[model samples]
Target: MDTKSLIIEKATILFQQKGYKSVGLTEILKACNVTKGALYHHFPNGKEQLLIACLQVLNEVIMTDIESIFRRHLSTKEALLSIIDKLIRDLETEGTITGYTFSSIVSEMATVSEPVRHACSALYENIQQIYSAKLVTDGLSNESASAIALLMTASIEGAMMLCLTQQSSDPLKTIAKLLPKLLKDI
Candidate 1:
């Protein structure tokens, strides 16, 4: 990667592992193996700007993955369950689950950083929009689809949080197994 991309890439991982407020620029610089001048050259405004960039990168990656997941499954319910199952599998294979990027940063920086909060919100809105679109394709009305997407988002995030806190993948696995039954009425 180029210098600017390298800076953003390293900063993204740092922000993901540690919250926006907890990671210092010095640590980012050291992690990137670049100097302060290089960082400032890439991010003129500094850590907050870098944090925003990291959020944007994560937002792109996550939304793109969600869109792909939706495209792969013809049934909206199957698509949603497949996503939950993937979360469970990922937790098992990786042996750890960090909370979602938007949740982690928003919890830490929402009150302090308007731009960061907006970026986080936009990321979630985009994901929900994708889910709603897929549900519409599955024959649900727009309003109901949107509401159901919101519930799925909350449930998935909560399951991830449980997995991370409990240090076990059982919570996610259980959610995956039970989600189809929960969605049967919808």
Candidate 2:
């Protein structure tokens, strides 16, 4: 990764773990091992801009993964399970069960920063649309698909939080088991 991306990547982890208010520029610089001059060279607006840049990078990565998963799976349920499985594995391996950037950022900075809030909202809406489209393709009406997709997204995020809070992956696995039932009647 380049200097900017390297900074963002390190900052992303710190921000996710500590929240926007708690993570300082010095900490980000140290984590990234970049000088203040280098950070300002890439992010002239300072920490806020760096946070937004990190969100944008996250948005791109998530959208790309969504597209790839949708392309690889033939059914909505399969795609959903695949996503949940991937999350389970990630949580198991990285122990980043609590490292959801959107949840962390929005809860801390949404009221203070319009750009950061909007970037987070756009990512969530795009993710919802990805899930909704798959459900529509699986024969549900747009309205039903959209509604279920919203529920699924909320449930998944909540389940992830539970996994972190409880310090176990059981909550995620339980959510995964109940997921198929959400689409069964449709």
Candidate 3:
């Protein structure tokens, strides 16, 4: 990868593991094996700028993957099931989950950092929009579909956290069963 991409890539992993506020520019520079001057050359504003870029990079990757899953021409329920299955498989393979979820990170930083808060909000809104679109395609009224989509997203995030905290995949399995039941109401 190019230097800029390398910096972003390294920053993404660090931010995911340590969160935005906890990580420092020196650490990121050392992790990337780049000089402070090189980091400044790419991210003049330093850590915050790099954090925003990291958020943007992660948001794009996640949104693209979600969109691709939703675009598989399945019913919304099936599409959602596919996503959950993918998540389970991924978690199993990775052994541990890393990454700052938009909601969790926002809640952690919102009181102190407006810019990061807004970035997290924007990422969530983008995800919600994608979910809403999928819900609409599944035949619910726009308002109801959007509401349900938001709830599902919130629930899934919660489940993921619980699963991660317990070092058990049971939460994922529970959601896999519950999600289909919830969708029947839609």
Instruction: State which candidate has the highest TM-score.
Output: 2
Model 1, runs deviating above 4 Å:
98-100
Best of the two (1, 3) by TM-score: 1
Where model 2 places Cα greater than 4 Å from the true spot, the runs are 98-101
* lDDT of each residue in 109-171, candidate 1, tens digit only: 888989988988888899899988987887889999899889878778787877877878787
The lDDT per prediction is 0.80, 0.86, 0.79
Clashes of each: 0, 0, 0
Q: Rank order by TM-score, top first?
A: 2, 1, 3
Model 3 clash pairs are none
Best by lDDT: 2
Compose the digit string of candidate 3's lDDT tens values, residues 31-81.
889999999999999887887788888789888888999898477788888
Residue 23's lDDT within candidate 1 is 90
lDDT of 2 by residue, 1-186 (tens): 899889999988888878889999999989989999999999999999999998988888888988899889998888989988888988899887434436878888889989999999988898899999999999999999989989988888888877877778888899899988877765
TM-score of each: 0.92, 0.94, 0.92
* Better model by TM-score: candidate 1 vs candidate 2: 2
User: What is the model-wide C-alpha lDDT for candidate 1?
Assistant: 0.80
